[model samples]
Target: MHWQRILVGGTKGAGKAIADRFLRGGGTVIITARSAPEEETESHFVRADVSTSEGTTKVIPEMLDLFKGVDIIVHNVGGSSAPSGGFITVTDERWQQAINENLFPAVRLDRGLLPSTIERGSGVIIHVSSIQRTLPLYHSTLAYAAVKAALTNYSKALSNEVSPKEVRVVTVSPGFRETAAATRMFER
Candidate 1:
């Protein structure tokens, strides 16, 4: 059982870490982000914005073309776009963007790709959610939290639906990581 194939959908941060781990484990990984990197690498990186339907449509075909199919999908992309002040500073546009970036990608990807994996009767999906979803500090991330809550609920229901079919759906929630971006936010 050589599980040497995985798909990591996210840019930078924890997502990159997950992909790197797969690579180090001798697995072939395919990654996607809003923009392609300047240089090429072993992993197939595609420029995709799963926040939009069009973006999803574009990426799915390219993904199939590259990996044929993946046994694991680790969704580690998500963040808050609302200002740090609180809910007041969060505009409607920002709210939507938060949901788009944090929730839509996973939903769309599962919709587009999970069927085949289900048909084959084996697959694993790991959704990376933030601890903010369950614990919040009353900042602009309220919308993000709500979206993630929805994601968790959706994941539960979806998992139940696919479990009998041999598809496994799991969620990974991370606390405040000491990353550069997080450090900057703390500095502010």
Candidate 2:
């Protein structure tokens, strides 16, 4: 039997890239998005917001049933909201949304799924964080930076908890990729 993996991301573009790469290497990949994809392959898509607990809870069970639990989890979901103006113009709701979007999904997914990874004692989990999390692009991204910082620290601490038991938890903090979001940010 082949090992299965899951890629959790809000937008499927980057996650789909990762999944296709993995699928080429022989592992089955399950994609989780707000709307499931119609593609027929090992790339199984499930619709779940994930930024909310309800969404994450609703999706994890279906995944467990499909693949008998994932051997790897790539937490590729993250993004920022708010206008081009500085911090002064931003509202509390956007700040809250940033935290919920960039951080909570990983937390919820790991909380619900890590137990199985621990039980198997052999899985690698990667969280796609952001360098703005540390560098702080300022203005609109300040809150995003702060939340991702919290997420990085949380991931590090969680690694300590699970690493000793054989699960590898690591985070990849990316700067601006030339994706649609970055292009728009540059244009603004």
Candidate 3:
């Protein structure tokens, strides 16, 4: 609960809220995104798209150097950028993008940071999945839902492997919330 070091994988929406909460609780918070947040904040900002390998590379070393490791790592980056009209409408590129955004970031971050956590013998990894994983809206979120399901599975497997080492991996599947991204999705 009283984490001394925290890394949030995104700096907007739920990710931003999580980082802010930790910062208010006096934790040293580090947040990453493809772009900086529109407003200023106290958390250490790392501008990197963690969905990609390059982005994870850019973030991991900096965080390891600065904090040695984090006590809590929240994988809070995910979304669907594909168009509407169900499975046939979603292109291969869009599916890959969905996997990159929804599944791979958490995998990469855990791969990068979990070693330190295991070494220290304690840490928590939180994956932000989605309710769409179970109740998929085929019209637009097919790829998103499928990838989130994969994320949930991955989180469970990771938890089994790491729990013995004193690391906790958790998956939180939240329903829709009216964030800026969700608002845009609805408007479209």
Candidate 4:
């Protein structure tokens, strides 16, 4: 089925790649991020931090108004700012930040938008995760790994809950790619 309105949760990395393909397919795409995309895209841009409920609240009304309704949601926002240390060295704030960044955006967006999808009896929600979730690197990615693991499980559980409603939920756990961040990591 052709998706008329698509919402992409992040706009500067893998999310941008996804948005580009949708735009190329003649779909109306809206991409959100805390800042503007470094490169231009055909998709509509919304500036909001999806990691926080406050940010999602700011964008949801505007998005629904503009698109009228969203048929597909691609949640691709996630990252780790936690310092490189074992779990014992990680702070409470860092753990919360990990959840906020990697997991909560998808949770909040789905919470806000899934009802509409249910009412329509059709929709798709794709959560992009990382392999680190299962094969964790405890030194630098302890918190990120933990939250992504949560996100993976949440996606699966949400799929089970929503599938009967005719809403399709998918979680994609991809290995490392040569994104700017990964490239920088290699250079370092």
lDDT of 4: 0.82
State candidate 4's TM-score. 0.92
- Per-residue CA lDDT of candidate 2, range 41-150, in tens? 56777878988989899878987776668889999987776676778766899888988898899998998888888887688889988888779878667777888898
What is candidate 1's lDDT per residue for 27-94, written digit by digit as tens? 66777878664455577777877788788888788766766666778777666656778878878898
Off by over 4 Å in 2: 38-41
- Clash pairs of candidate 3? none
RMSD of 4: 1.8
Ranking by lDDT: 3, 4, 2, 1
As a whole number from 0 to 100, the lDDT of residue 74 in candidate 2 is 90
Which of the predicted structures, 1 or 4, would earn the higher lDDT when compared with the native?
4
**TM-score for all predictions?**
0.89, 0.91, 0.95, 0.92
Worst 10 residues of 4 by lDDT: 1-10
State model 3's lDDT: 0.85
Top-scoring candidate (lDDT): 3
Clash tally for model 4: 0
State the TM-score for model 3.
0.95
lDDT of 3 by residue, 20-130 (tens): 788788867888888887788888898898889999999889988988888888888888878888889989999999999988988888899899989887988989899
Ranking by TM-score: 3, 4, 2, 1
